[model samples]
Target: MKEDKRPILVFGATGRQGGAVAEALLKARWPVRAIVRDIAAPKSVALRQAGAELVEGSFADLDTFRAGMDSAHGVFSVLPANLSETEEVRIGCGIADLAAESGVAHLVYSSGASSGDTPTGIARFDAKPRIEAHIRWLPVTATIIRPMIFMDMLINPAFGLSEGRYTFFLRPDQSMQLIAVEDIGKFVAAIFADGIRFSGRTIKIASDTVTGRQLGEIFSEAAGRPVIYSRFADEVLAANSDLGQLAAILDNGPLADHVDLAAMREINPEIISFRAWLATQRHQAFDALIGSDRTSHSA
Candidate 1:
């Protein structure tokens, strides 16, 4: 029998969630192998500098993906969210098939919070359910993590946060879960350590729960200026079908189904609160958006 030589192969290792997972795995001294379309990409180079072994590959290439996963102890799988219609399902099935064929012991798939038995009516959010179903039939032991809306997403340029105010899909007073990207890494590393604890289990991971008013307060504190939150204006959504459709789904679906904060704390005791995260991240985040520098004092 050939001795196992490959490390845990993490797909989408250059992106937010997978990158965080790879960093945590390396910090725990677990060998991490990352698949990247371009090893020369700055993010990929950063992963390499952080001690990740890189495999040049794309999601469309099953052969390279199989080689990357061969005899791996586990795999951290996260796909980019750019696919059209149900193509996201196709890519996920392809990865799961290759992992099982390569004899991977465990697979951790990162899915979205919007994925549920009932469709959310949003293509992007609803795409994961099909992929989750596909992973079920594979011979590999798989753990699915349905993560809440990323706190960092609030700052995306398209979200109007960089402008004066903010508009999101959630209604005021409706509680929704949010997780820091770093916490996803912490949570996933825990899963990788004891796949038995997580295998065959689909878990929702979150760091904090907050209402729209709470989002406003945090934004105000982080920006050192008042910021208000409201449902996207009907006219706004009507103009931008993509954003509008997502907003509609959030309004009608279980998008705001609260995650048990107590359970998440049990899994990651060090989960940061929204206020603390804002304070810690404000400077860099502001810099990215406004090209202005601000000083952050240690709390």
Candidate 2:
């Protein structure tokens, strides 16, 4: 956005969150250098095609990260959720150290809304707080963004959307903030564009907040059929401890009241809501899931 053309080095560019950031940065005319594992991977190739300077590397490889961050303007850090807490923290913190040591101007770390100083007994959520703490000790100007639950999860067939029923961590009347993956990039781009305003702040972002019942209504309207919505059944939760812990968090945890739609709209005005995401970007996926077995099973 200025006369300087240094790129913002982006990690996890092949995945959902990172890819969104990369695309948004490119659209904003900011140069992006994406660190990827497989240079020939489809997502990696696509990044190159989209004007990203792809650098082959892994998160654990310090040499590769140092090289990529060298002389870069900023760094965007996000680790895979499937990783263990120790590994996630190590890589996340290491990136911050590298960014600061590399003289990067700004660092943006993608953390979960439910993540905070208190442990939620969830590994993925707990790891971020550790990473955040590490960044606090560094000299680099950093913005920690806590993104609410993703709207994309609702479309997963395992969640029962393919069968016209969606089970989640909320009661029909209770509300939870949901963010579109597409919106994550916009928020991140804004944070990078203005370091002075967002640095040293932990801002939570969400495009829309909806109750479970509202989700059903939106899905039904989009699918042209009835879609039931309900909280995770007690039996289901008890059967899976991980899901059970997450559901518990939703009931009473950091996730309950994190999103401020008014503030988010101010930062990224084009924030997409659940209905808009379903009607637009996710329509194909929704159609695929609903049409999966619609003709064979008429439940």
Candidate 3:
């Protein structure tokens, strides 16, 4: 089949979610144009090698965003949550506005699981619903994807993987949804391919659901050693209000993912489970973390 000539412009292409979207679009034979702050960066170079056209740009630059969106048929939008909630909302809304003005056919906004019609009292989570509202008001067709917790986050040293114990927000029997970072791209690509089917839809996505104990079991099996799992200790939570708030949100239900895994799999059949994700691209990293005695200061 002849590849689509019109490209899908992707934001944050140097980062995980956008990079995944770019790769998946490329695999599906859709032309991809990635916006990056530096085209010379290693990840940008990798994107170029993978056949993505690189556009130098930052979220703060409207001109760069317009240039990237030029002649684009679709857009995969994602922003880092490291910024203040106000800044996140600004950047996200700005992207949607640009996409609308650029006459982009479809806009897929990657949001967090906690975002919805009501406020979650978490600034980061609330920022997304605001963005979603902005996108809906725009003239352009849009899809909002609320992705569950990332499987990739499990291997982070901050999770105490290096200590043979994983401490997270969920209770021992409490199940949380998770998605492989790579699958985010697959879902985006699918949405872009059939815009009418997904347009105006707010979809929550996940590859697997597991409790804290299940996470420990999976980690132990994958690492060939017994790994323990426990909820964040009281002192630990007290020391970090942000962590405490997140834990409370998880327990209270808004932040806890309730995605339909079977339905998501039907949309993107290659969706990877938590165990599968750890055993694949993350295997080496997970192995290294398990073997190391280095402690992480961040929660």
Tens digit of per-residue lDDT, candidate 3, span 81-104: 687899999999999999999998
TM-score list, all predictions: 0.89, 0.94, 0.92
Ranking by TM-score: 2, 3, 1
Instruction: Tell me the alpha-carbon RMSD of every candidate.
Output: 3.2, 3.2, 3.9
Which 10-residue window in model 2 sums to the lowest lDDT?
290-299
* Candidate 2 TM-score versus the reference: 0.94
Point out the higher-scoring one by TM-score: 1 or 3: 3
lDDT of all predictions = 0.80, 0.88, 0.85
Top candidate on lDDT is 2
lDDT of candidate 2 over 77-179, digit per residue (tens): 9999899999998888888999989999999999989986679888888999999999989999999999999988878888898877988888999988989
- Local accuracy of candidate 1 as per-residue lDDT tens digits, 1-299: 12343478888788888888998888877889999999898998999899999999875666778778766889888988888646788888888888888888898999988888887667877889888998998888999998888888777776566665667766787667789999999999888877788998899898888888788877666665666778777787899878876776566655657777888888888887777777785467654653343335343
Tell me the lDDT of model 2 at 15: 93
Q: List the residue pairs that clash in candidate 2.
A: none
Q: Model 1 off-target regions past 4 Å?
A: 1-6, 158-163, 234-244, 287-299
